[model samples]
Target: MFEFAWPWAFALLPLPWLIALIAGKQKHHSTLMLRIHALAHMGMTNTKVTPSRKWPHWLLAIVWALVVASAANPVFRGEPITLSEPGRDIMLAVDLSGSMREQDMAYQGRFVDRLSVVKAVLSEFISQRRGDQLGLILFADTAFLQTPLTRDVDTVAQMLEESQIGLVGRATAIGDALGLSVKRFNEKSQSNKVVILLTDGQNTAGNLKPEEALILAKDAGVKVYTVGVGADGRNQGGLFSMLGSSGAMLDESLLKTIAEQTGGQYFRATDTQSLANIYKELDALEPQAEQEQTFRPVDALFYLPLSGALLMLFLAALWRQLKQQAVVGDA
Candidate 1:
């Protein structure tokens, strides 16, 4: 409803009039000084003000009222709107090593590369995450932050879909991925920080080691969920189980250690069905708040009265100038 933001400002409504009354007792003799609050005084500012030419006392009072009303901060408060903030921050670190080129995962009854399946699944996953800050990391020979933490899940999904296998290098860098995630999480975290690390091979490249990254994440209170993606029957031109999980066999033990130490879980996605289940589990992560928040929108209306006051002042000045010119002509 329409109201004054600061109702106490109305107390100043009589301030200008009080000043007028007090000044009425003063007596001064000066031929040059203007004796009233009129725009005419602007031309003879140095003159001592005295009881002289009749001023528009009523106009001045109306102007003062308008100015006082503007200062009171009139506003129209809108209805309260409930905001459903997700409140959680998530980082998805995907392996883009040469091994990810393996055609182990089946899509639409046809074999596709590991990265393709990841892009499809994760893009859908990213779309459902509303109000949560999501980030993307692509790792191969090393780790790289593809997208910083943001609420724009559509952009995050676009980045994920645009990724190509072996874009960085051909070797997996699990430690570098985890370490990079930790650094990002520390940079901007409001609530919980979660890392979903997906890889089809063991950590064979990178400066940092898996054990070292694990300690770093645990110390920073960063939770990690490790996903090992390679088919059990990796032979017959699939992916793993034949060449032993692209470049090297899946390091289940290291993945498990990292997850457990960081207070997370380890999931093996040998197929698309299992990966979907993993998504369900990830969805269970705690949000920033259990209850929604609400806030009222306000629109300031002070400008309305403020504009009127300025216009009245301008007109008064113009009127005083006109009267002064008429008097000079008459003289």
Candidate 2:
């Protein structure tokens, strides 16, 4: 549909006519008629004052009308769009403690760090989450929100990929991570609020205890799915493998408790495949509706009329200048 953004501008369409009417009245009142004998005595010919050409005045009126039309801001609106309500608000809390550097997880038959495997799998998971608000939280000695709950999954994925071990600190703050997730969920009024926490070790730092965080999560009605990521074998032999070495220390009891307390499930991911499978299960549990959304596309048309008006004015001015030059040359 085509319409004017400021239709009120059309009210000024009579402005030129009003100005002409007032100017005519002023001219009539200011008129000074002299007798023909007085003019002959002054050696003046009986010359009549010829009225100015009306074409220029008419052209000016047209230009003014065009200018007013442009000022009305004409636009072409496509169609109205309706958007469906979002499915879920999922917050991802990943462990960035020093232990996450352990390389027990396999990717493409090659050993990779725990964090790398998480990033690769999580990126795919994020891509699949259409119409869901996703958030990212990185935790080490403390927890902090990397990205707020948003529908921009690509941004959350980028932030996850950019995260490095020990970015916050070397110790795991599981309680703080859960607490922060719960706090964030409370801020939104979404019906389905979820938190997926991936960590490799027990909580060694933070103000709140894991149990206390679980209480808050329950109160907020936020579901928390916890994943304990590491290799199973006690004697795994990778150059960076900390599983058989001193780095393997997962608090499965606490993780399972948090998940169960919040009416969520606990998953153990020993390799990249398992982690991917865990996220797949999550997708099944919280399936997104196939419904669609719509919105109108608008294109501004003010420039069209505005440009036409400017061009007409320029041509009118050029014509007047040329006519004046011709008169002067003839004289």
Candidate 3:
């Protein structure tokens, strides 16, 4: 719909008319009389009087109307737009300790490190969270919030993929990762707050303990899904298998406790496929909302009327100039 933003401008419509009336009165009062005898001597009595050329009064009135309309600031309001409100605020915490450098996880028949496999699978997972705000946390000796909770999942995913082992330090800070996630969740009012914490080793560094972080999560009403990433079965052909040694030691019990205490579940990801499956399960658990909220959009249309007023003024000036030139030529 069209509407004036400043309807008060209409009150100035009679200003030009008032000015013209006052000027006419002043001209009439100042009229020079008295020179009948002088005019007869100068041949003014029989001289042909040339009528003064004037522009149509209605044309001036149209210009005034255009200027008034432009001052009113017209606008066109568009229809309301509906947007889907996100159903969940999810934070992804990945371990970047030295242990993540171990090449125990396999991706497409090739051996890859735990961090590499996590990035490959988690990137896809992050993309699938269409209606959920995602954040990233990287932990080693200390945990750091890589990205804040945001609707731009692509940026979060890119940060996740760019993460490298030992970026923070060589020791795993599982507790710190959870603590940071909980702290971020406390800032938002969303009811469905979730954290997906993936780690390969136990907590060897950090100020807060796992139990303390779990308590904080429970108090903040944040659900945490924990995953212990490592090798599943015995290595059949690797050098570690020849020496009868297993891969890195993962603290599964602590992870399970954290998840269970926060009303979430625990999953073990020994390979890329299992990690992908875990994220798929998470997607099923936290679904996007069906109903969406809406808002109206408005666009200003003042420029359209203002441009018309300017164009008309230009044409009027050109017409007046051409008429004056024609009169001069005839004279």
Candidate 4:
């Protein structure tokens, strides 16, 4: 893929030779003592002048021509890459109410809270989505955008994992979460816009209603997938159940309606394995489009050829000076 960007400059390569020829024919007069002729007169010693050491200058000129050619930006194009999986933009809306601390979901024969498992699984999920712009929204009594839509998935995940329950008070504002997600998505609507809403309770707080938020999402061409997490029915008082002190049930119908309104589906994750499976199923819902991109590395090949030419010029000049000094010494 090597190419000379300035092929027209080759025409000037022979111009130096013309200058050399003209220089050789230029008339010049020099005075010298002619003892053999017994001429004391200042006679004309003019003769056709030629370079005694022409090869150095010729090499120097040729090298300079090459340097000029290299400086014209000779380029080597590399192969292009096809990013088969086109990136998408996703916003994860998580519920961080007091109920999220319920330790009903079992993981490896032990019960863990909803948030613990969510963090563990989400960390892995975010890793798989490279090149995609991801965001985080945590909602409880009020919905707050923890991170804006960005390509930095690591930062988004870190912020999500660092979030604690009751950051905005202890109430589940499902509608506000969806509304905020819709607003964020509308800020920069991409080819594929999505919101993964995970909540363990119903909307008890926020200015907007669930139906109103769903309408906003539909209007903005945004898809909303709702996930209702926690075990179904009620759990009797156990040794370490956080919900043992109170009675509550997750609002599946509202979550289902939100998902249906925005061309998405509702997923019920009662346990860790089911939650993992639900996310795995979601992985297939949105297929990435193949994209092609071109990349050209801007390498500075000028230094290579320039350095070589400079070194040659230096050596030539030094040799000429040394030859002149040697001639003077011999005389």
Model number with the top lDDT? 2
Alpha-carbon lDDT of model 4: 0.77
TM per candidate: 0.84, 0.78, 0.81, 0.80
Query: Model 1 scores what on Cα lDDT?
Result: 0.83
Q: lDDT scores for all predictions? A: 0.83, 0.85, 0.83, 0.77
Tens digit of lDDT per residue, candidate 4, span 220-307? 9888888888776355444324543222477888888888888999998878888888879888987554565656654445566667
What residue pairs clash in candidate 1, if any at all? 33-47, 35-50, 98-170, 234-240
153: Cα error in model 2, Å = 3.2
For residues 1-331, could you state the per-residue lDDT of candidate 2 as single tens digits?
9999999999999987888787987776445343444556555765644233344667777778888988999989998977765788899999998778877777998888889999999999999887888999999999999999999999999999999997999888999999999898888765588899998888899999998998899998989999998885443565434333223668888999999989999999988889999998998877876666788888889888778878988887788778877776776
For model 3, how does the per-residue alpha-carbon lDDT over 226-245 read when each residue is reduced to its tens digit?
Answer: 99888953444554434333
Each candidate's number of clashing pairs is 4, 1, 0, 0
Off by over 4 Å in 2: 6-57, 79-87, 150-152, 187-192, 234-249, 289-293
The residue-by-residue lDDT of candidate 1 on 1-331, one tens digit each, is 8999998999998888788678755734332254343546555686543334655788878888898899999999999999877667889999988778788778879878878888888888888888888999999999999999999999999999888876888888999999999999888645588899999889899989999998899989999999998775544575343556552388989999998888899999867777888888888754445568899999999999989989998988888888878777776
- Which segments of model 4 are wrong by more than 4 Å? 18-55, 238-248, 294-300, 327-331
Candidate RMSDs in order: 5.6, 4.2, 4.3, 5.2
Q: Could you tell me the lDDT of residue 208 within candidate 2?
A: 92
Deviation in angstroms for 131 in model 2?
Answer: 3.8
